[model samples]
Target: MPTKPPLIHVLHPGLFTTVQDLGRCGYQRFGVSVSGAMDPWALLVGNRLLGNPDRAAALEITLHGPELLFEQALTIALTGADLSPTTNGFAIPMWTVVAMQAGSRLQFGTRRQGARAYLTVAGGITGPMMLGSLSTHVRSGLGGLAGRAVKKWDQFCVGPAPRTAAQSIGRSLLERYRPRYTKSPTVRVMPGPQSDYFTDDAVQLLTSSSYRVTTESDRMGYRLEGAELPHRASAEIVSEAVCVGSLQVPSNRQPILLMADCQPTGGYAKLATMISADRSLAAQLAPGDSLSFRMISAQQASELFRSHHAELDRILPPCCS
Candidate 1:
């Protein structure tokens, strides 16, 4: 007989929790947005602790976190946001792998910091694969567990634990790998493809002024309320392909930084693009959080990108390689 898959019974699906991986790639021309973990670094850390591959699906917990009961033995790790998690009522440490007994309850209290967290089980979360990704594009209603945030009573199948010997204290993620979400961060950016469309002063305003994240922000984009960016000619530009971190300035003049769930194309004049090195920090910003931008040359951004990946590999040598 085929063995039954291990399950996790969700007692409560807090705020907005969904399954995510690295993201669906190479389908933008077909109009598919790469919707995955907003804080992918957290996801990577969790998976590394559990000895799972980089693409393994994990729970992306937002604002609040879910209460779960494991129906089978599991090894798990939590990363990113500190939601004050507890296992069977005992406080559990973040950035560490812990073995869980069957029937044990896992819960979260008030969010201490960070906007989103990641929970990775041994192996990974099992779900239908769409377009080579398990990530959920909620707006499109595609991928992940029925393409929605998990709900109470939802029972999810989990892959079997890794065959290799389990980690001891080595599963603890190093401090350097842990990201800080409590402070107002200055994000780095490079000129966008349509930067020429904007006035020189508009670009200066973006880099010089502080912006507050608005309540209208979501996984799709961070709408900032700050200095207006006037166009040199017109704010309208030919709809062009955009990517994660593309800063699109619409007619309203308030810039919206496109994110993980951003559309495939946009018509607004592009101002700047956040560097890959700072995307994780951008992911942790909550509503009302203040942030500023620093301009960097394309060469500097590329070098930083390489350095960031190197740091990840150093932090999790076993998994990143």
Candidate 2:
């Protein structure tokens, strides 16, 4: 018989903490967002450290973090933002496997870096799957703790762990696989489908100007305040497909960086789209943080993606991925 899974009690729910998996796919056509971990690389690293599947559900602690009480001994991992994670008032290291004793209290304090953190257990957090994913989209309330953030006194459990699985205790992620995030990160971008709708000066301004993320930003998209990219005529365009990382410029001229939970389609003219390689860095930025864009050719973008994908592939064993 298989060993039963362990439970975790939520002592206090942090600001905007939610359960997330990779994301929902193939349902965007019907108007669904690919709401998942903003920093997927970090989430994957935490999961890999705990010997969980790449898409295993984990807690996406945004900006703030929660206090958790373990009912039984369990092994877990932390990654992404350095939220000053602690256990029983002692600091615990991120990007490594950590063993917790029964009744241990895991808490987080001042954020040292990045905008979000991920906590992963050996079997990953168990949650209801909607649209083939366990991601939580607050507005739609589709998945996760009943389609919302974790609440105070909420209880969670991990999936059943394989009895034959090896104990990956003390495992630490290497630096090469970890994405270095900073307050101002310059991400690479490719021209958007409506690139022709903007004037040449607009393109120049976009690449040359620095943008600050406004507090109004959320998981849906970022309302950036920066050099206004003037359009050739109007900002409106036919509602079309838009994906995460889309840099849409409206009549206001300031760019809007679409993120997780962004609408499947948008009408504003998009100037560029951040490349997949740099999306992780963009995801780590918070309100008031600044960022710039560097234009790259489509071919260059593909090359960068291949190189980045190769790096992620090395984070775990073949079977683990």
Per-residue alpha-carbon lDDT of candidate 2 for residues 24-61, written as tens digits (9 for 90 to 100): 98899999889999888888878777778888999999
TM-score per model over all chains: 0.96, 0.96
Worst 10 residues of 2 by lDDT: 160-169
Off by more than 4 A, model 1 = 168-170, 318-321
* Residue 139 miss distance in model 1 (angstroms): 0.9
Local error of candidate 2 at residue 293 (angstroms): 0.7
lDDT of 2: 0.87
lDDT of each: 0.87, 0.87
lDDT of 1 by residue, 166-249 (tens): 764336887775788864789999989889988879878998889999999999999999999988888887788988999999
